[model samples]
Target: MPQMMPINWIFSLFMFIMIFIMFNMLNYYISIIKMNNKMNNNNFLLKKNNWKW
Candidate 1:
């Protein structure tokens, strides 16, 4: 039982770190997608205004 304790802790810690890293990667990708969408919307608006003029 004593020897198993350290192995269990190590396994849990490794899993926690992996989940944290994946969450950060997801957030980074979402932010990039949002920025690209904003840029496209602005470009569309500018083109519409030019067409009106």
Candidate 2:
């Protein structure tokens, strides 16, 4: 007898996983961007106030 796994099932699972990974990557990038913006703003403010590292 042929194995019972359906082709559509496997394809759907792969698609779901790919979408999930993409979402996670997008979320990670957004967080990084937010942090970078915050850091840049702080640096700018500090420079305006004559602060140094």
Candidate 3:
């Protein structure tokens, strides 16, 4: 029998890649949420300043 540990290698590499993908996705959503909050604040500020117009 020949041994190169192919099964474990594939499983571990796939797991490593998936964890990386998940971390990137989490970072993207956090940025999006922060941007959305800023936009909302700006809108409120505009309305507060332009109440006569």
Best by lDDT: 1
Off by over 4 Å in 2: 1-5, 50-53
User: Which runs of model 1 end up more than 4 angstroms from their true locations?
Assistant: 51-53
Worst 10 residues of 2 by lDDT: 1-10
Poorest 10 consecutive residues by lDDT, candidate 1 = 44-53
lDDT of 3: 0.93
In candidate 3, clashing pairs total 0
Error of 1 at 14 (Å): 0.5
Cα lDDT of model 1 by residue, 1-53, tens digit: 79899999999999999999999999999999999999999999988887543
lDDT value, residue 6 of candidate 3: 88
What lDDT is reached at residue 17 by model 2? 100
- Candidate 3 Cα outliers beyond 4 Å, as residue runs: 1-4, 49-53
Q: What are the lDDT scores of the predictions, listed in order?
A: 0.96, 0.92, 0.93
For model 2, residues 1-53, the per-residue Cα lDDT tens digits are: 24656777899999999999999999999999999999999999988898467
What's the count of clashing pairs in each model shown? 0, 0, 0
What are the models' TM-scores? 0.83, 0.75, 0.70
